[model samples]
Target: MLEEDLLYILALQRVKGIGDINAKKLISHCGSAKNVLKEKRHVLQKINGIGAFTLQHLFDKGNLKEAEIELTYIQKNDIETFYFEDKNYPDKLKHCIDAPILIFKEGNFNLAKQPIISIVGTRKITSYGRDFCEKLISELKPYNPIIVSGFAYGVDICAHKAALKNELQTIAVLAHGFEEMYPKSHKKYVAEINKNGGFITDFWHNDALQRENFLKRNRIVAGISEATIIIESAEKGGSLVTADIANSYSRDVFAVPGRSTDNFSKGCNDLIKRNKAAILTSAKDLVEMLNWDLETKKERAIQKQLFVDLDETEQQVYDFLLKDGKELLDIISLSCKLPVYKTITILFNLEMKGVVKPLPGKMFEAI
Candidate 1:
C-alpha cells in the first residue's frame, strides 16, 4: 500500500469506538480510508452502523499526528504492514469477519501457500504436554509447515523452539506492540525467531502490554492458520479461547487427548467431548485430516515409484482402489472394515508408497 494510504489507515485506527468490523464497513462504503476520514460527518452517518459516537472522533487532528509518528517509526525500522484487502495478507485470515483491518509485522518468513498451524496451550505446561508438542512438530517436519504461537512460556515457546530446531519457519504473535516484549525473558529468542520466521502484531509500536491484549490477539493466532492444536490446557485458559475462535472461523481444531486425572488435560478432553475439536493422538491424525500428504496431479509422476512395499492395511487399501478404479474414502473404509481415521492413515501410507492417489471430493484411485 502507498504510504499515504497507510497513513490514513493508521489514523483511522486511532479513532475510538470504531473497531475492526466497523472500520471495515466504513472503508468499504467509502473508497478508501483516506476518503472515510475526509468524508463529511452527516454523509458518513448516513451509512449503516456509522453513528454519532463513532464519527465523533473520526476527525481528530491528533489521530493524523500520531499516525505520522508511527508511520515514521515503521519506515525507520523497516516494519512490514499488511492491509486486509491486500493480496499479500494471509489468505485464511482475510476470510474472517472480525480480522484486523491492518496488521503490523516484522519477519523474514513468507506465508504464501504454506501450511500454517497455531499451537497454543497453557503457560504451565507439563512434561507430557512438552513431549507431545515437540514430537508432533518433529514428525511434521517433512511437510514443511509454518509454526505459529503466542511466544509466551510453556507450550507456545516450546512450539516455536521445536519449529526452529526442525529448521522450519515459526511466527511469534505478540500481545503487545513491536517496542514492548511482554516477557522480558523471551527477548533472547527474538533474534533467532526473526531469522527463522518473525513476529507479528496488530498493536502499535508504542502500545503497552496489557492482560486483555492476550485474548484479543488470540483471534489472529486462530485465524491465520489452517488449523489450531491444543496440546494442554487447564479447565480454563487462553488456549480454549483460541479453540473457540478457531471453531467460530470454521477452521480445523485438534486437541491431544490426555489422562482424565491430569489438570492440564481437562480443557482438551472437554473440547473433544463438546465436539469442538478432533482427537489428536499423533502427527498422522493432523496430516490425514488436513490432507497434507495428498499429491497433486503434476507431482504424482515424481511421487510414484516403480517398486514399493506396503503393509497389510496399506495393500488392502491400494488393492481396493485398483479394483474399483475410484471410490469415496468412506466406502473404501467400510469395504476394508476399518475405521475412517485408520482408513485415512492407510490411504496416506499407500499414497506415500506410490500405489494409491487421492482425487477430488474425498475420492481415491490406484496408480
Candidate 2:
C-alpha cells in the first residue's frame, strides 16, 4: 500500500507550494490520487487554492523526471518509503500539517512503537552538556526508552553516543536526503548504528540538505517524539525552535537548568522563563514527570550489579570452587594468583555477603 500510495506522493512533493494540505484537498475533490493524476486540468482548478498559479505549478511537477531518479536511488540504497496512510507511518506524526508525504529510512527501527524522548541543543555545548547526557541516560536506561536526537554536534551527538555505549537503540532524524551522509564525520558510526537504530528523513535523494530545509525537519523530530529535552542552548539557538515546535505539538518539553552566567545555557533559561519548558535537575525528575515507574524494576538490576563487583581473581576462584570444594590455600595459589593470607581475607568478605560457603579445611563454594 505504501508503494502504491507513494506513486501519488512523489508526484505531489515535486510541486513547489503544493503540500500535504493542498494535496489532500485535491485528492478529496477527485477521488484517489491515481484518479486525480488522470483528471482534467479544470477539475483540479475546482479544488480550493488551485487557481492558475497553483495549477501551473502542479502540472509542471506532476510529470517531472526527478521522482523517477529518486525512486531509482531509493532502490539502490534500500530505503523504506512510507506514506501517511500506511500503517508503518507513525501515527503521532501523521496529523501534522507539514507531515512528509513520504518518509525514507533504513535499519530495523520502528518509529511507531516505544516511547521516545528527543534531546536537542546547540552545537557549542558545555561540560554540563556531557554530564547531563550521561547521567540522564543512565537513569532512564531501566525503562528501555528509545532516544531520539538530530545527530548534530554537541548535545545531540552526546545523547546518541551515550545510548550506543549503553547498548540501547536510538533514532536520528536528518535534515538531508538518504542518498548521502550530511556531516560526513558521523559516517564512521552509522553502520554499527544500523544494527540497533536508524536515521529518518522525508527528503528525496534529489532534495539536498539546505539551511532552510532544517526548519522543516525540526518539526518531524519534535512531532515524532513523545517529549523533548534541551541540554544547553544560546538564547537564539535552534534547540529552542525544536522546543517551540514540541510545545505546538502538545508534547512535553524539558530543559536542564544551567548557571545564568553561561552564554550557552541562556536558551534553556529563557525557555524556563517563558514557561516553554520545565527545568529538570536530574533524569529522575524527567522520569517522574513522565510518570514512568522504574524504581521497582531496578531492584533486580541492582542485585546483578552487586554480583559483578567480585574481582576477576575472586570470580575465577569462586567458579573453580563451585563444582568441587577446594582448600583456601589452593584457591589462592592456583586461581587467585595472590598470597593465601590475602585470599583468606577476601573470602571472609564474600562470607559476609553470603556469596560463598566456607566448608571444612578452608574450602568454599558459591552460594
Candidate 3:
C-alpha cells in the first residue's frame, strides 16, 4: 500500500464505533480509506449500517495527526503492515469474517502456503500438558509446520519453545502494541522468537496492555491457522474462547484428553463432549484430520502397501476405498457401519498411512 493510503487507513482504524467488518463495508463502497473520508455524510449514511453516530467521528482531524505519528514510528522502526486486502496477508485469516482490517507483523517467517496451527491452553499448565505439547511439536517436525500461540505463560510459551526447539517457525500473537510487552518476565523469549518467527498484532504501537486486548487477540490466534489445539484448560479460560473463534471460522479444532479429575482438563473435556473439537491423542490425529499428509504425493501401489500398516478399522476404510475407487465420506461411514466421526478418524489414519488419499468435496480413494 502507498504511504499516503496507509496513513488514511490507520486514521480510519482509530475511528470509534467502526469495526473491521463495517470498515470493510465502507472501504468497499468508497474504494479506499482515502475515498471514505472524502465521501460526504449524507452519501455515506445512505449506505447500510452507516448511521449518524457511527460517522460522527469519521472525519476527526486528531485521527490523522495520531496516524501521522504512528506512521512515522512505523517507518522508523521498519514495522511490516498487512492490509486485509493485500496479497501478502495471511491466507487462512483472509477468509475469516472478523479478521482485523490491518495487521502489524514483525517476523522472519513467511506464512505463504505454510501449514500453520495454533496451540493454546491454560496459563496454569500441568506436567502432562507440557510433555504432550513438546512431543507433539517434535513429532510434527518432519512436516515443518509453523506454530502460532498467544505468547502467554504455560501452554502458549511451551508451544512456541517446542516449535523453536524443533527448528520450526513459530508466531506469537500479542495483546498489546509493539511498544509494550505484557508479562515483562517473558521478554527473554522475544529475541529467540523473532529469530525463529516473531510477533503479530493488530493493536497500535502505543496501545496499553488491557484485559480486553487479550480477548481481541484471540481472534488472530484462531484465524491465522488451519487448526487450533487446546492441550489444557480449566472449566473456563481464554483458550476455550480461542477454540470458539476457530469453530466460528469453520477451522478445525483439537483437544488433548486428560483425566476427568484434573482441573485444567475439564474445559478440554467439555469441548470434546460438546463436539466442538476432535479428540487429539497424538500428532498423527491432527495431521490426518487436516489432510496435511495428502498433498497430491503419488506413491507406487506396491510401496504404499508394503510400508503402511493398517489396524482393523483403518483396513476397513481403506479396503472400501480400494474397491470403490472413490467415495464420499458419508457413504463410506454408512457402508462401513461406523459412526461418521469414527469413519472420519479411520480415513485420516489411512491417509496418514499413505494407503488412501483424500480428494476434494469430501471424497477419498485408495492409493
Candidate number of the best lDDT: 1
Q: What is the per-residue lDDT of model 3 for residues 1-367, given as tens digits with 9 covering 90 to 100?
A: 8999999999999998888988988998999999998899899998898888888899889999999999999999999999988898887777666789999989698987678999999999999999999999999998889999999999999999999999999999999998998788899999999998999999999999998999889999999888999999999999999999987766789999999999999999999999999999999999887766544333444465567877788877776665445667876886677999999888888877767788778878776
Give TM-scores for every candidate, taking all chains together and pairing residue i with residue i: 0.81, 0.76, 0.81
Clashes of each: 0, 0, 0
Q: Which 10 consecutive residues of model 1 have the lowest summed lDDT? A: 297-306
lDDT of each: 0.89, 0.75, 0.88
Could you report the Cα RMSD, in angstroms, for every candidate shown?
Answer: 10.9, 20.2, 9.8
* lDDT preference between candidates 1 and 2, better one: 1
Instruction: Indicate the TM-score of model 3.
Output: 0.81
Candidate numbers sorted by lDDT from highest down: 1, 3, 2
lDDT of 1 at 234: 97
Of candidate 2, the 10-residue stretch with the lowest lDDT total is 322-331
